[model samples]
Target: MSVKPESASELFSGPFALGTFSAASGPAFPGLIDREGQVLDLRTALSDPALTMRGLLERWSAVLPQLRELASSSEPVRRPLEELRVLAPVEPRQIFQSGANYRQHVIDLHVAHRAPDDDRPEEERRAEAAEIMDRRAAEDLPYVFIGLPSSVTGPYDDVTLPAWAAKPDWELELVAVIGRPAHQVSVEEALEYVAGYTIANDLTDRATVFRRDMPQIGTDWLRSKNAPGFTPLGPWIVPAESIGDTGDLQLTLKLNGEVMQDESTKDMIFDVARMVAYASQTARLLPGDLVLTGSPAGNGMHWGRLLRDGDVMDASITGLGAQRTRCLAEES
Candidate 1:
């Protein structure tokens, strides 16, 4: 149930972007998508039929110049973009997801999920949440968790809403694609390690977020978020250099053509640099690893309208790209 957008070029920005595409049910290959809606097969262009998008990122420095020159010239082997099936731009080995990184989003969660017995006024609750967020931003470290790479699916692929998932939700995020090796890198140098940017919808089963059976164990991110096709990632990756300010990117998610989440990256309590640096402190950030900056203010929990069968989600990040995913109920 893949729904192709009206124009693929409108979803991406810049003169060119990188992606993975397949033709006539053939094996996927690295593709260079130009603004003219043409795809130049990187496998043929680079004389490596087995090249993957992650493989290109591993040698991004050496490959980028060649890509630029190839994009500029008239290539004889290019194909029409509409004739191919787009896949996830890169297959990441590690996915680091930041949690509660958005200021208003955390505040909304705090206010919405308060104890039923608590009778505090809404304004007071919101104010208390804001103060807590401020204190955390000023003093505490970012909250990050590991996500499975196996959960990733193509941007336009259908997402199965598991029958047990009583409350499925969408949390569209801006993902930073790593190019350079980073271990215990400083916040100042974190951005330099980013190769490019892409969009990811961090789908969650809100019902399984907390483990009632093991309260002391706290949140169960694996059960809540690691289902297959839980993360629909990338129409393509836009070079970080092409996007000057990571702080001001706009993230928008529309459910059935109605905008549910529309917020700016400026609201992030822990920015991309901080999240990346924090993750690098514990693990080696390699090329093709993804650092997902937390989602913004509007989510299904905030609006009290969760996902259903046949619901379509149209998610996009500024200059990065858009992903259109359809929801289907899992058969019993």
Candidate 2:
């Protein structure tokens, strides 16, 4: 029960979790996350021009019949997931990222368990202990960091940067896809509010996450975390209906098939429902908006753990599928 955040599957279970996603060659479309980091085609179910952001939305399977009808009658050549390029499942007008969501991640990385009553001697130890609970809960909160629309990349893509950069690394993460539009919801209503799940690596710069424990860390989190190719998502977008509970799967990140980080979603202090519920209070979550759950501390950005050019990084979160990317040095 005392395992690190990398091993708990309390948050990644579900039907979509068992598959991959794919779409037309030119543009990105929603589908399922498969076993080997590829997208399973959802066909015409997601291509409906008449699709409404607001509808019955009762079950993910309700649309299957319609999808079959469209696929069989296809007059144009259908695209194969393997042949086309992949992209982030959600296309939210804006993006949001989370910070500080796992317990062992805090201690293992020396992230000071900052709290309100450190000044009160009695509360100092208690505050630190609370991090254990808060760590799991924080994954659901995501802390809301913004990103550039142009910076997103697909599964198996390259995570690259200019040689002049200070630091660059990868954080294996689970990305939550919103099913419908929502504002001001409750934890009790969170799971029902989701569309599906995807995988993401929240790469960060060492100079960014560990600076003193104040406002500066926040500044670096967004900058170092959002550079071009920092967010490698996709491969699939299994509908929430297909994926049962997302909190019960195995997640593993390996460098050349040798495990570096391994865990399950169950360790997430904050579960899925609370995350969507908490976010709706301040911001609007649209159908294509992406909520990148936080990463465990095993990322390469910690001190001696930085990434190097040519290093292969493989990230897989339970049912959402795995992503393989190579670190490349930008050309001069």
Candidate 3:
């Protein structure tokens, strides 16, 4: 733990999906680890035979043939049965994120911030000091957030809105994962430390957010951000190397397959270079660390329609894959 780990390879050193991927000896794509467990050993299922760390490090994205070959004859580092008990792969740390990284989100939140008296009453106003922190800090890209690691539900997992959230909204965000240690990096060369991309929904409590009369309140995004199973990530992460370029990608949000929001990464107020450079200027970005760019438009708030218990939402980004979630509202 004292010395820098020279042996670690960004691709192989996972916050992996846990189960064996279909192409074990090749790249591991993210997927829902069904409660019943199926197609879990993707790595072992690959045609390639050498399903070890050496194979993965050297082969990164080579797509060698026979990569999907079953590894029934091979030995696993851990006992097979023991592996099944392991929970789904998730980041060990809070997934870091930025607020208003996108142009539309900034304009949207800005309007909300300038509204009249808060819908919440006097006592409730004092209580939600956490939510108000966002209004003041809603300036631009490089806004950081410490996400709920436990809140990470798989791509197809159920997203539940607490009974108290009157306006549960979905915000589609593209998340960047840090592959290497980047401290005080320059925007000119920040891409070197990136590992890959994934999808994140910055779901918020809109009812409390757009209150027209009051000043913004609260440090806790707890009410507005951290709803149960609110954060959905995975489907799979495209290796940063595979991504080629971070800008100019298409981002979209849909409800039951109907497009509600369509925007391009080019609209991002701060590009990846500026974002990574700014974040690293003061804080250290470690492996598995996430830099969540803020969401684009087409959220429920813009319509005044809130997420209901049975509503389904999809957050998709080009190359990053889409995460589909079913909303669950706590009922009395």
Q: lDDT for each of the candidates?
A: 0.91, 0.59, 0.58
Candidate 2's C-alpha runs over 4 A off are 1-80, 111-142, 210-218, 301-303
The stretch of ten residues in a row with the least summed lDDT in candidate 2 is 1-10
- Give me the overall lDDT of model 2: 0.59
- Residue-level lDDT of model 3, residues 1-332, one tens digit each, is 01111112112212232222323244443222321223234343453444432233234334322222222223222232222222113353546667666655555554544436556554554434334444543654356657767666656667778877877888887777666678999877888776567777777786654334544643456556776677776555556655677788787888766787789888776777777778888888776667787777667766667788777776678765456678777776
Root-mean-square deviation of every model: 1.1, 7.7, 11.0
- Give the alpha carbon lDDT tens digit for every residue of 60-97 in model 1: 88888998899898874788888999899999999999
CA shift at 161, candidate 3, in angstroms?
0.9
Give Cα distance to truth, residue 208, candidate 3, Å: 4.3
* Candidate 3 off by > 4 Å: 1-89, 117-141, 208-219
State how far residue 318 of model 3 sits from its true place (Å): 0.9
Q: Which of the numbered candidates is closest to the native, going by highest TM-score?
A: 1
Give the per-residue lDDT digits (tens) of candidate 2, residues 144-192. Answer: 5666655677667777865655667667877777766779988778776
Candidate 1 worst ten-residue window by lDDT: 5-14
Which of candidates 1 and 3 is the stronger one according to lDDT?
Answer: 1
Residue 77 of model 1 has an lDDT of 75
